[model samples]
Target: MESIDRRLVHALQIDGRAPFAKIAGVLGISEHTAARRYQRLKERGIRVRGALNRFRLGHHAWTLRLRCTPDAGPALAQALARRDDTFWVHLMSGGTEISCLQQVKNPDELLLDRLPRRLVDVSAHNVLRGFASPGTWRGLACLEPDEVAALRPEFEPEPPTELTPLDEALLGTLEVDGRAGYADLAATTRTSESTARRRVEHLRRTGVLELRLDADPSRFGFATQARLWMRVEPRSLAAVGVTLATHSEVYFAAATTGPANLVASVTCRSGGDLYRYLTERIGSLDGVRETETAPVLRTLKRVALSEGEAFPCHA
Candidate 1:
């Protein structure tokens, strides 16, 4: 995309409600051009939507790293990509491990109970803590306007899903800005503010939509994030898993089939916090036989759609 388009994307990532006129002004383009560019981007499988800070909303988000056989890599990855429960999946470096994110109503117990049964060679962890930031398109942000325009035809989007008209419209508005006002949503959905509010409530109740604050880990003082892996006897899994899940510092956890039966992603405000969690929290847990850790140095792709008007796992 053009530098102007990148600027527009950045603006939207910061505030999805940024008016087209403002984006155009910032990019020295016309509002119509800005609008067209955004529509085009959406057509190209680039999602511009509201990302909920689910944790703040009383839901827990966990990243699960899978260690599967090389032969099973593609198969497992594809299976996960097609599952609605998995928010994102990636073949890690060397393709030996796959990383994924799961948004669960609760992260502690179910995460552990579900993994061994979910995939053949899955290793699990409730990441004690980790850092996260809203994904931006700066990398894909360099497309020129002409490039974006030229690519429009090839970028034809899949038709919207078979949702109610209101559901379809609400998804569109929320895709543009998760934090949009009820009045704004009403205008977009062609419904009254009260109706829009009711629609949003319904979406939430049905688990189709989640709204939350998106935080940047570095900005939040979690410069170092690591998934702490632990091995526990099957009998101790439940008691230990529940304890770790409810701990504020433990962001996500799950059970796996590997040596480290339990895995956790952890975040700390400082090095001191990290030291305390490992020495105090983790070390204190019984039935943990051995432990291993992998620090997430960088994350390439965060999440994707299993279905809908978003990025489909199929090519």
Candidate 2:
């Protein structure tokens, strides 16, 4: 991608709903150019979608890693990907391992018991807290601090409210397209345009939903992506997690349960860059005792709002 295109993507990452004129002004390009570039990128499957913030909704999140026989990995991963609760399904370290994120109100024993018999090992780390997520990562370092601040939305917290069936229906539409116009939202939810607008605003103010631009890192010159699992001293876990979260290379960082108490996803220009990060950055952290890195071979499914749909699972 051209430098301007990259900057445009960064702008969208900061605010997916940023006006074309605003993005053009930030990138020192004409509004026409910005609009055209965005159209091209969207044609390639780079898109922004509204997603639920599970934490804000009081739901528990988990990082699930499954090691399976080579032949069974893809099928198992796909099965998980098809479920509404699972997101970020990935094939890592070749095709024998699967990694995914899931959010739910409570543990589902029935879901766990349905795992494929061919699985060799399975680990589900409860994500106690997140220091960074797609919405928070500063991966595109092209913009100035002021430029970034200009694109950010003014946040005003709202009181928590139970999600009504109408709200869920509205969310389902937004999940597919965050930039959907008020008319579209109103039509989908079968309500007045003013009512739809007010409800969506309330959801955003309360932090129950977030809109994020999802794009492949490789498209922005980041060719290597890896997942880092680190065992940190319990006392220093918060410090280490916070530190990792501040790095531009770190996309997702969270404190999790199990032996590897913290897990982070990082993107870099190459293997050498990843090595430097692990050695110079993470290795120097005070509480990091051991680290294991897994290269993401391919992503079968990326982040999406839970559709809350049910599917048959292997028992």
Candidate 3:
């Protein structure tokens, strides 16, 4: 990717709904050039999609780590991906482990007690707090400081909003294309364009809706991805999590229940890159007592739905 293209990706990460003209202005390029570059990037599997932050609406999220028989790992990963309740399904630790994030209001939805065939072990950790995610990751950053400020999303206090059927329908279209125009959104949700636009704003204001940029980290040269599960001293847990959230290599960091108090997802350029990060960065952090690194051998599902390409090897 060219410098301008990377800038565009960075801009979208900040505000997925940012206008192409606005992006072009920040990059000091023609609007058409910026739009064209984005289209090219889209062709390369980059996308901005709508997402629902159910956690903000009193929903609980759990991260599951499943260690299965080698032969069952791939099949189990796919089975989990086929369900709408699961996301971020990964094959890791020599293709014998599967990790996924799931949100369910009903405990029965988890079904952990009834392990599927060939499964050896399963552990589910309740996500207590989150410090970072792809939306907050700065690994793809390329814009100058001023340019970043120009694209930052505004924040303001808002009252709690109820989720209506119309809002759910509207979210359906956005999940496929976050940049869908008001007219297209209206057509899908069977409402006026003005109504569609207002509803989107309301959802965003109330923290129920989010527009996220989805792309392969390897496409931007950060190829190696791994999950770092660390046990931190109780008092410094928040401090360590806050620090890890800012690390360029980390895309997801959160505090969770279970043996490890903290977990982080990171991407690096190579094995040496990861080694240096673990030694120089994590090693130097206070209160980090023990760390277990699980390299992601394949990502079967991202935050959203499965990809169009042939499945089985990704991330």
Candidate 4:
């Protein structure tokens, strides 16, 4: 069994709608205990919310990569941090290049399309066909120095095993359309409504699926977007990564191979807001060595798992 906190997080991850009483029964604890633990978890930044389906919400998505001047790394990072489409941002060794997750309504709005007119001496690589993580895979990475602090290590929870084919299809549909109804899913999967509902519950119970509404950021007033890349001292990565992940503007964070050792996706309401986040929040983090930024053009897809494919291909 998962630790109390992890168990609660896992329960919420599977189905944010699960009542405290149900979780209490599963963990053999009082409902009050479950509620108190949940409150504490949220205070510590352990979010247990539903995932969003960007496509269903009517927005375009894409990823963008950039090559920058080493001297401009910090400035570029600050610039990208201020946009809504920019989901993550980072600065690499000496700040020569940056990459980020970007989204736009149509091809014409791509930041890359306007880069030549806006910024000089920069190169880009745009991934037209790729997916993002369908679930929240990023958590604080453990560091050696962190062992000194009283940091409570959060164990990675176990993923559910053995989903039925019907379960898989229902999950696949919801991955793209979180609001899909039980009756509609039942019709598509050729099952009774009650059966479909049961399978959904099972999938949710076993941590195999999540069903929730995710809206496009633009619709909510966040308009600017970009991808930022950063290079930090290897020893300081854990602290730096955790700091970036906690930012309200940051949507995604992960370690990657490159001079810019870390990557992040950030969204903002305006260019001014993006700039303020980078200079005030990101630049203020300790152990950060340098950074880079790349504004995104258009997002083709945001990591929909319906394709059932794994990333970082292996032979």
Tens-digit lDDT track of model 3 for 6-88: 88899998888888888888889999998888888889989888777666566668888999999999988898887766767
Per-residue CA lDDT of candidate 1, range 1-315, in tens? 466655565555544445677667656789999888877656654444543333433455555677766666666666666654455455643555677766566656344454433344554444333322223212223445653443222222232223478976786667455647789889887899999987666665443454322332443346765666678888997677667755655544655545676666565666787788888888898888777765554333333232111111111
Estimate, for each residue in 1-315, the C-alpha lDDT of model 4 and write its tens digit: 135665555455444445677667766789999889866654553433322223222345444565665565566666665653554344543465555555455646768754533333453333222212313322222223332122222334444556568876776666554435678889988889999888766655443343422323453356776677778898987677667655657655555555666666677889899899889888888877787766554332333321111111111
Clashes of 4: 38
Sequence-dependent TM-score of model 3: 0.93
Q: Give per-model TM-scores.
A: 0.48, 0.92, 0.93, 0.49
- The runs of at least 3 residues in candidate 2 whose Cα sits more than 4 Å from the true structure, single-residue gaps closed, are 305-315
What is the per-residue lDDT of model 2 for residues 1-315, given as tens digits with 9 covering 90 to 100? Answer: 788877887888888777788888878899999888888988987877887666566677888888899999888878887876787777888888888888878877325678989888988888877787766667776888998888777867797688988788888888888778888999988999998888888988877767777677787778999988999999999898888878999978888889999888899999999999999999899989999999998777665632211111111
- What TM-score, to 2 decimals, does candidate 1 have? 0.48
Winning candidate number (TM-score):
3
- Lowest lDDT 10-mer window, candidate 4? 306-315
Best by lDDT: 3
lDDT of 2 at 35: 84
Task: Select the stronger candidate by lDDT from 2 and 4.
Answer: 2
- Native-vs-model 1 lDDT? 0.55
Total residue pair clashes for candidate 1: 29
Candidate order by lDDT, decreasing, is: 3, 2, 1, 4
